[model samples]
Target: MDLKRRMQECDEFFRLPELAHLVPQRRRAALEQLEQTGGYLQTAEEILIGAKLAWRNHARCVGRKHWRSLKLLDARRVRSARDLAEVCWQHLQMATNGGAIQSMITVGPPRQPDGREFHIINSQLIRYAGYRNGDGTVIGDAANIRLTEFATELGWRGAGTPFDILPLLISTPDEPIQWFDIPPELAREVELEHPEFDWFAELGLRWHALPAVSNMNLEVGGMTYPLAPFNGWYLGAEIGARNLSDTNRYNMLPLIAEMMCLDTGSERNLWRDQALVELNRAVLYSFRRAGVYIVDHHTVAKQFCDHVKREEAEGRACPTDWTWINPPISSGLTPTFHRYYDPPDLDIRPNFVRRDFSGDGGI
Candidate 1:
């Protein structure tokens, strides 16, 4: 969350040889732009809003398809990490053609976050820097087709059943850049290694020359559940990219991750404990590449929950009723205490209470 500190770390990290020489001025410019653009945290916050929308959409679709089953929808469409990287690369290329230089943003630990860290890069400014060959034949188109072929060959699938290809299709190259091409050796490898390459070869389409650009937002969340305190903590990160090119293209891929520590103190009630368990499992199943850490809830939640009890216990005031109850409820003889409990409020019970983590209203 400390934007300035993280930016400084990023500045130092990018100074390494592999990444440093690639874009020295651009890197400095990005750092300066990050400062002038209101720092990493602020920019990340804005991107989070968009990522949430994307996450919600993905969640809804997955829920609709397999909410009944405990098993999550498989993301075979996004199967390999390489597939994601390629999509990101195309998106960056698209942004470049739009006359906007791309900026990379990272957040979390001095190294990497335990949960998820969202990233957003400018896609409109970085130019495609045209792909060329030693022989002078354009290679951008060849590269694009090869990327898609590689993805197909990998049998990649996104999260969910029958994994919606829409995200990938939209995220893939969107424009036709005559200059962007792939190398012959790489193209040959695709043809040799992937059986699907036969289809491309038969179609007479240079499988390696297909253009790709991705302009999609990503939202990933991670959480940990503790049994003792009977509560859960969550961390979320998100990023959005817009492909400016007609063919989906990206120059670089952003790597993201997150971590969460859960408190489980007030878990006396079996139902509450069950809720916490389900919540944790759900989050794990939903987000890949997320790390979770658990803590004793009783130690943490004791500081938060007023009362913790098992279902058998009676005379225990519902925590929600007390927390939000505007006027003290009074029995008719006393004053009519129960009437103040809104119908909705009466229906809803606090099975679990959070302790350690906080952000965006516990979505």
Candidate 2:
């Protein structure tokens, strides 16, 4: 992304009444800076609002209703990998907020003119280590198998548990890849238990409290920050329906169905469907029982619909991806699944872009 060119095209950056008058001046300065150094630094206000606008413009997110509440942490001056890790650690604590789970983004340094940038290897700040065994079995989240192997190659080891927290992995232009153990206290987790199922706790299922995506690049105005980790609280279906129940991930439905004595002899019995609902119930119950912030799919879908209405009232188009904005389970039951929306526009500025996990064997 080129900041100079983006400045000329994206008027959202200068849309605020406070910044409107300075658009001409800012645009001129950005062009001058680009000619001299091939980049321009964004002001604090620009970064802050830009991050929020990015969230608002993210079509896949169902939680965009709370975009204005996003908190920003400017760490653009962080020079070393260790310093980046330290700030990321602080980001976890702040975003977790003792389970209140504040929405936040910590912007690391922008990609340099030399084409080098900082990187956070883990897709999420906290993820279960996935150990792929020689026998084709997996011990943890199957989705993270490559990441676990990458961490192990870096000399990090886990207890070989089903839900071991993976170490934070990062890399810099000048340094080799590095890993750090999240302080035990900072790695908050909620033990899963059904509110009424006495044996559910015995299943020993748990998930980390935070869902920070650390590997995406934040593209605001014309600058791209490769290490801007951001997070919000969980949407229960994300964990219950996709993470745990997905066939390739934890694959917990079969065990849970067997435990529930659900009839599995025939697809007509809808065993997987039954297990899915119960599993989602357990997840919602567990998080709420543990005082962690989480929302049920129905409620979150309603909020998204509401957000779309608000955006319409403002004469702004709310771009949305139908598949992503709808809940994975019982999507037809929500209002979000009932209507069409503006298709996602990839050209939107102040957006978060997924980082390509290639080279150096990084995942």
Candidate 3:
């Protein structure tokens, strides 16, 4: 993007109506530099606003009800690989907040004028390794095989479990990509167990406490931050319906059906649906009993509808991607499914943009 357009986006974010009360006064020199050279978020208030705006403008996310409450941690001073790893570890702990997850993002240094950017190769802060067998069967999470291979190429050692957090792979301009092991305590996870099914605990399914997506490039005006890892509390369906039940991921629906004694002999039995209910039940039950923050699809869908109403009241279009607004399981049941959403912004500013991970194509 051109520098002038980027500066205007930064200015618009600074002047957003939701943050009207909290907006800080800008300095004369900074304002001059913003117009002439380029804009950069200077104050804590500006940083916070930028991060919040990014979340609010994320068209594909249905969890933007807490966008205004995102905690911004400025880690722009983290220059070395060690410091970057430490900052990420700290971010995990802070976001987890002992089961009461906090909506948070840690901002790394912005993109340089020459287009150099810092990036983490892992898709999420925590994910499992997938080892594919000869006959196209995966031993672990099938969705993670490509990333697992990447980590293995980087000399990472997995624990050979259903769930394993990937190591941090950070790359910058001058330095070759460096991999760092995530601190054990930082990646807190919960073992899946059902309230009714005794065999559920025996399956030994586990998932990370927070889904901190680490790869997206965060743009705040003209400066694009390449290593901003951000997270929201998980939705029950994301864990149960998609992650565990999907064929390309854990592919546990068939196992779950067999365990439940559901008729999976034919497609007419609706076996997948029955199994999904149990899986979702286990996830919701486990998170509640473990005192972790998790939202069910029905409740969050209603909350998202309310968010849309509020945004409409404020004369702001609730731009949303319907495919994402609808949950993986029971698409017809959620409130978000019935209604049409406003078209998303073509160029959403102060947002996280996709980045190229392999062979240094700058964002």
Clashes of each: 83, 1, 0
Candidate 3's residue-wise lDDT over 1-363, tens digit each? Answer: 677776666666656665577536653344567777554546666667777888888888899988878998888877877788888888999999999999888888877666777777778878778887899878888977887787787798887766777788788777888888888888888889999999999999988889999878877644678888999999999999999988889999999889999989998999998889999999999988898999999999999999999999988887798998889988899899999999987587777787776563331
Rank all candidate structures by their lDDT, best first, as comma-separated numbers.
2, 3, 1
Candidate 2 weakest ten by summed lDDT: 9-18
Better of 1 and 2 by lDDT: 2
lDDT of each: 0.25, 0.88, 0.82
Against the hidden true structure, what lDDT does model 3 obtain?
A: 0.82
- Per-residue lDDT of model 1, residues 41-114, tens digit only: 22333223222222222211111111111111112234233343343444334322232222121111111233
Screening candidate 2 with a backbone cut-off below 3 angstroms (N, C-alpha, C), the clashing residue pairs are 3-222
Estimate TM-scores for all models.
0.17, 0.96, 0.93
Q: Candidate 3, residue 104: CA error in Å?
A: 0.8
Model 3 residue-pair collision total: 0
Q: Tell me model 1's lDDT, rounded to 2 decimals.
A: 0.25
lDDT of 2: 0.88
- Deviation from truth (RMSD, Å), model 3: 2.4
Candidate 3 or 2, higher lDDT: 2
The best candidate by lDDT is 2
